[model samples]
Target chain A: MTGQSTVLAADVPFPPSVEDFYLPSIVPWGGHDSYWFTKITALLWISVALIIIFFLVTYRKPKLVPTKKQWIAESIYGFVRNNIAVDMLGKRGINFAPYLTTLFVFILIMNFWAIVPFAQISPNSHIAFPAVLAVISYVMFIYIGMKHHGGLKYFKHALIPPAPWFILPLLIPIEFFSTFIVRPFSLAVRLFANMFAGHMLLLVFTLGGFAMLNANVWFAPFSVVSWAMTIALTFLEFLVICLQAYVFTVLTASYVQGALADEH
Target chain B: MGMTAVAYLIAGMLVWGGIGLLVDHWVGTKGIFAGIGAVVGIGGGVYLIVRRLGA
Candidate 1:
């Protein structure tokens, strides 16, 4: 068994870092310089395109009675509407259903890319992507808040937090800092950091298995355990992908609600 | 790796918080905008570390 284990480890190939992961560019713009940006951007667009095409194909003809694709589309829409928006934002949430649905589905697809065989990297794992999404949410909430309430009142509501005047000295500044500044930043970092760490962990176990295999006969059997853990973790990552996407969308709706609320 | 991760998380929170404060000040509204900014900052900071290190 030990002899076979060592041989098995030597035969396996471990996955590498994102920097080392080679994805063929859809259209090769340049070789070395454009490697990260061109390919990654193209893949990102592909994901976006797939999403659009999916919806378009599924809902080309709307009907009271649905087809499989339409059902998928409807189910996805319903999930976001009922589970996230309504649950988090209440009756007012119905208005935000479309935006929340888009956020959830878009993020879910991007995250699912990590588990896909050929496309193993998650777009959200890239800080820039999450940062952009965070900015979008920030703008959406702030704009809605200001648009609904006068800017002066909105700012007052955000900072004041319905507290006493004496406490105002300390509370006001802190409220401003948390509500305006920290919300969006955490919004982006939460998604980015989770995906990044998940990908890195998967990489570590995968590579460790391979490295151990070659180290000695005794190390070979451990590769089986490593591989087993990796498989289990992959399933957990799937849950995370969905959970994170939901969390992001729900939080976005919450922020929007916060902005639109008459009082803090 | 751990230190780098911590630094990135902290930096992200501070940058966002600072931006929030600047935005509030620029808009010329008086209230505890700074307080909101700090809450958002600390929330983001803790969220980053938890998301990364937690399962």
Candidate 2:
């Protein structure tokens, strides 16, 4: 038991760090110097390819009597359209349904990788991916507002609320901070933080199990418990993946709805 | 809707408290302005929420 525990201890690195998020470079064959490509990149590309191919193949020929594949594809689109877009934006929701559906699907797949075998890290755990998505949503809502309200009047409408003249100064800055600054920052940070935390939790539990097993014979029971917790947390991670994806899509739709609303 | 309300509350505090901190720096006050700023900011946040999110 002593000898086996020692070997196991050496195999498992206890207490994961930020460095674990940075996987070894795949291109140039595991070279440390270059991160030209990594598992994260592969997961992202695979997600994109899978989504595109799935939609294209499923919808290549429109059928009045939908097949299973078509039903699944249509269900995904219809769910976003009816549940998120239309619910949030009303009549104009159909116009934005495609983009919102794409966003929801992409985020769901990217986050799902955290619980997936082999590819155990989600690209969204990295802030860069979520930040980019947030920027797109930010720019979109502003653009829609400007177009709907006509020119700089959009800023006027968004910033100047239906309040009296005396309190305008205080309210304006608050509105600016909340609307302009907070919206995108929160959007990106929310998604990035959720995925990042989810991955870190799984790593801690999984590695902690091995660490315990390596520590001593008596700790073997605790090791099994830790592994069980890891399995349970994976199921929990699946829930977060779906939720964050839905929340991101819904918030984006809500922002667009905010932008498109007429003056009261 | 929940997130938006949170953002508004946080934004109000941040915007006002930040302004207060700057005022404290300029006036050489001992955190009084900062405290005042936060309260005022939060008050404005509640008002904004009522106007924007209230039915």
Candidate 3:
């Protein structure tokens, strides 16, 4: 098994690092100086364009009889609208259905890139994308809370739970830290870390094959097993991709619900 | 709800443990304040969880 391909496998960079995530510049055509455009940027724009074009094309004609494309579009929208938004937020969910649907679709597509043939890396593996998404959720919930509760009353509602006066100091700090600090941080890190770890796992298995094959001719069968494990992990990665997207959307909706709730 | 509970627990430890460290630095004690802060923080965490999530 470790035949002529051993020469080609010699360059397989074992133990992939964080540096592997920093892809080269696309605009400058592999130049290191300007990273204004890269695979991550391209994937992001592609996801945006694909979503826009898909929805526009599917909904171009309002058919009572529902074509295949329209059904798909409707199903995607309906899934997020009914299941996530409405289920979490009740009648008020309709107001947020559009934003939540868009968020769900965008994150789903971005995460799907991890298992894609040519595009093996997801843009979400980088913290920037998820961080921005988390910030939006954080700001949106706070804004909604403030609007609903009439000013600083939202802070009182969120931070000052239904508790007595004496132990208020202890509980208050925990609530503040959990709500104000932990929510956004965990939201961003959860998605980023999942994608990052998934990619790293695939890299390790894939490159480990080459490393094993190069170690000894007797290890060729082990290299094949390693490659097999990579294939298995790809399926697991798919499950994670859908799960993370759903989790992100659901959590956002839940946070919105928490904000909009009237005093427990 | 699960995430919220976890956040509460972690936040309790971090907030109190961080305060404990500050106290330790101030009082020139070793890890005593830090340990006490951690214990107090976790206790607060459990109380918060019961009050907020036990329903």
**Scored by CA lDDT, what does every candidate get?**
0.75, 0.94, 0.93
Error of 2 at A214 (Å): 1.7
Off by over 4 Å in 2: A2-5
lDDT of 2 by residue, B1-55 (tens): 8888888899999999999999999999989999999999999999999999899
lDDT of 2 by residue, A146-208 (tens): 999999999999999999999999999999999998899999999999999999999999999
Ranking by DockQ: 2, 3, 1
Worst 10 residues of 3 chain B by lDDT: B1-10
Model 3 chain A is weakest, by summed lDDT over 10 consecutive residues, at A1-10
Candidate 2, residue A58: Cα displacement in angstroms equals: 0.7
In candidate 3, which residue ranges exceed 4 Å CA deviation?
A1-3
- Backbone collision tally, model 2: 0
Q: Worst lDDT window (10 residues) for model 2 chain A?
A: A1-10
RMSD of each: 9.2, 1.1, 1.3
| Candidate 1 lDDT tens digits, A1-264 | 467755765665655666644555444554655455555576688889999999999989988999888998999999889988888678988999998898888899898888888677788888888999999999999889888888777787665645456645544544555567777888899999888878888887887887777776787689788878889989989989988998888788878877877641
Instruction: Please give, for residues B1-55, the per-residue lDDT of candidate 3 as tens digits.
Output: 8887888889999989889999999999998999998888988899888887787
Better of 2 and 3 by TM-score: 2
Clashes of each: 24, 0, 0
